[model samples]
Target: MKIQQITKEVSIKRSVDSGTEEQRKTVQQIIRTVREQGDQALFDYTKQFDQVELTSLKVTQEEIDQAYENMKQEHIDIIKEAAANIRKFHEKQLRETWLYADQHGSVLGQKMTPLDSVGVYVPGGTAAYPSSVLMNVMPAKVAGVKRIAMVSPPGKTTSLPDGVLVAANEAGVKEIWKVGGSQAVAALAYGTETIRPVDKIVGPGNIYVALAKREVFGDIDIDMIAGPSEITILADETAIPRELAADLLSQAEHDMRASSVLVTTSQNIAEQTAIEVERQLADLPRYEIAKQSIENYGAIYVADNLFQALDVVNQLAPEHLEVMTKNPFEIVKHIRHAGAIFLGRYSSEPVGDYFAGPNHVLPTNGTARFSSPLSVDDFMKKSSIIAYSEEALQRNYEKIAAFARLEGLEAHARAVEARFK
Candidate 1:
């Protein structure tokens, strides 16, 4: 509710980018216990934590099939429509392994190949995000990954969310497990008796799930270790007050810690936007969460000018950035970092999340400074290929031999030297 001027320096340490240390310690313990006791440990943890009593750790094919029967045709149709959007967007990223031959008939190039398998982690609760299921699986399917597995916690009141199972089925996930939390990550990373270890893991999750992913980096691949959602709006006098308010509240609905900030050159616009936010907040379903987030993490800055506002944006590197200014594209040319940039007044972040082509699994907590959103490239690998004819080997043998000798290993030189001998 308070407005402040943006000086050359930020005063609030620009907010620290870190996970809670206590959460990390708790998650590490979960990972170790699950790794040691396997399914038994997982069941105990699930009952102790999620308050669910499960007979099996894996979601059966019957469960997935029944999920379809319970859903309305219209809801299924929407999932299909969303899947088509996700597939269409990711298809542009598909690639084939390539080879090139020189005039000498020597072949050399990098081979692009899909990873052998990947695991997707979906959070579980009364409300489920079928969108996340599609986002995590469609890209791997697009990349031609052979096996895609899913691990989501089971619900206590009802079965796993129908949309979740339906989306996973539509996206070609090979296996689905009724497990979640750090234990799910450990199972996916280390392989339980029933679940096989996967080449990579991708999805949105809580603090424990994130820390578990962080600990599993070497044993398996993971998507970015994300933090709370954040959105930054860089505007001038031209920014639409009503639209900017909607965008700020969009991210605030994600969590109490999620951040939404409006930085502009015009104080008048800032005040108007704040008023618009208050008006719109009354209607949103998650108003309490959004309000708490805004009260604690939200901010308004009246910069000296558009250039100064843009400078603050670079320092924040928010997960979702909106350019709500005259000539949004013109102003974006100078911007360097953001998980996703919505260039115009009409392009809100939620459109990209539910229906638009790009992935919503973006870096958060200022990680966009160095990381990128999830994509097909995250589910593929490249193997370098090299081949040489005898004549070519003979030409380079002396240099190769010298390089080995310089490293103080004569056996390495002899391996090549013997060929020339």
Candidate 2:
């Protein structure tokens, strides 16, 4: 980890991977083939990429039961409890269709409707993240989406991970598929023989999956193109160095591109945290990955004061921000941009990642400046409601026509005039 003195506003903006020409071309071809061949394309791709032969695309009840058998009862209970917590949190974001009327007999409002269907992509291979399943699906379910489909590439045994399956079941997802990569995204965008098209696709995956989402974006909605995990800790003299290092490495271990940064007022704390991070890296199972991440992207900045440190945080707009100052609440008001804010020493970033009610699917890179975490609103669409009584129309029709004519939209002017006549 490198330590530097903060002198001016700094940006930790990383270049987002947009895929190579070859990869983009390949994704386009994959999408085209799935649209043309449907289920056969998915099966062929599964065999080629995943090395698993599948007779069917969908997960069966027997498989779900077997998944339950494979998982420990305690693990299942934990997933259920996590699901309950997630659902309870998202249910608060649920909205009702509303309309308002005035004395003029004009009604205007917004009608909120959940998407008809959604597809959630859960990554497979070296690790399985059941937490992601809960984070992605619970919001759609809370918004009253009728169908939620889950897709993950199969392993050699031709089975999805037990934890992933259990989480999906607990989150109320009925449809699960044993396919992944660009092809699964294609299948979700354009209906296959067995899998129907969904209105939107959510969740995280590899570069190929991100490319596929980008390819099919306009045709079918997708969540943001997520970047590597990042955590920026803002601490003071009162903060513990070891705890700060541990929290930073939690994200560093995620990927080689993950970034861990500390901006603090105390130089002593900065030097100690850098040493603590190096010390902790030795024990991490993903040592090489974390070590590389810290070497390339990690940094500790010595700020003149708390105000100067916060300016850097706002400029970076990190995916995860941890405030470990003496008074985190006071510091929180100064933070304008962060995907998720974990305040004080006890609220570690991992708490929000798993057990905490907040959705872990948050904007990465500097996108936190403009976007937000995945919520129930992402799974729902709003329709503008407009109603005008005859009296109201008579009063405003000429003015409406004149305004339309001012824009040289004669047809629009005639429409309002015709309504009045």
Candidate 3:
């Protein structure tokens, strides 16, 4: 880890991978093939990429039940509890269709409607992401989305991880597909013979998945193109060095591109944290990945004071921020940007990642400066409702016509005039 004096120019922003031209071309071809061949394309891609020949694209209820049998009862209970917390949190974000009448005898407002269907892509490679399933699907379920389809790349056994299956079941997702990568994204964006198209697609994936989402964006709504994981810790003299190091590494282990930064007012704390990060890297299960992440992207900044430290934090606008100051609450008010704030020592980043009510799917790569975490709103669409009474139209029709005429839209002007006539 590198230690440096905090400056206004300090930045942790990494260039987002837009995929090489070859990869983009590959993704485009895959999407085109899926559109043409449908289920045959999905099955063929699954065989080529995942090395699994599947008779069917969807996961059966029997497989889901067997997934339960494979997992211990205690693990199942934990997944259920986590799902409950996620659902409870997202349910609060649900809004009802609303309208208001004005003095002009016009009813105007917005109607909130959940999407008819949604697709959630859970990546499968070296590890299982049951948490991803819960975070992405629960919000759509809370928004009253009728159908939530989940897709994950199957392993050699031709099935998803037990935990991923259990999480989907707990999250109330009935449609699970045993396919992933660019092909799965294509299947979601365009309907297959078996898998129907979804109105929106959400969840994280590899570069190919991201590219597929980008290609199909206008056709179907998609969650943001996520970047690598990031954690920026803002601490003071009262903060413990070891705890800060541990928290930083938690994100570093996620990916080689993941960034872990510490901004503090204490010079001693900065040096100690850098040392502790190196010390802790030796024991992490993903040791090489974390070590490389720290060496390349990790940093400890020494700030003159709390205000200066906060300035550095806001500039980074990290996806996950930990405030380990003496008074975390006071510091929070000053924090203008952060996807998720974990205050105090007890509120570790992983708490929000797994068990906490807040959605762990957050903005990364400094997007927190303008973007927000995934929420129920992402799964719902708003329709503007405008009802102008006869009296109101009589009063405003001329003004509306004149406005339309100014914009060179005579048809629009005539339509309002015809309404009045």
Clash pairs of candidate 1? none
- Model 2 over residues 159-203: C-alpha lDDT tens digits? 899999999998988999999999999999999889999999999
| CA lDDT, candidate 1, residue 314 | 87
Residue-by-residue lDDT tens digits, candidate 3, 1-421: 8889966668764647889999999999999999999999988999999889999888999999999999999999999999999999998988899999989889999999999999999999889999999999899889999999999999988999999999999989899999999999999998988999998999999999999999999999999999999999999999999999999999999999899999999999999998899899888999999988898888888999888888888989999999998889988889999999999989999999999989999999888989999999999899999999999999989999999999999999999899757
lDDT per model, in order? 0.86, 0.93, 0.92
Each prediction's number of clashing residue pairs: 0, 0, 0
**lDDT per residue (tens digit) for residues 1-421 in model 1:** 5678987764322333456888888888888887888888878888887899888877778888899999998999988988999999999988778888876667888899999999999988656989999988999999989988898888884357989999988887768888889999999999878888998999978778878999999888888777778898988888889999989998889888888988899999999999999999998999899998888888888999878888889888888998888898798788888999998878988888888878889987778889988889898999989987787788888999899999999999999989979
What are the clashing pairs of model 2? Answer: none
Give the lowest summed-lDDT range of ten residues in model 3. Answer: 6-15
| Every model: Cα RMSD to truth | 2.2, 1.0, 1.2
Q: What TM-scores do the predictions have? A: 0.93, 0.98, 0.97
The model with the greatest TM-score is 2
> Considering lDDT, where higher is better, how would the candidates rank from best to worst?
2, 3, 1
- Candidate 2 residue-wise lDDT at 252: 92
Candidate 1 regions with alpha-carbon error over 4 angstroms: 10-22
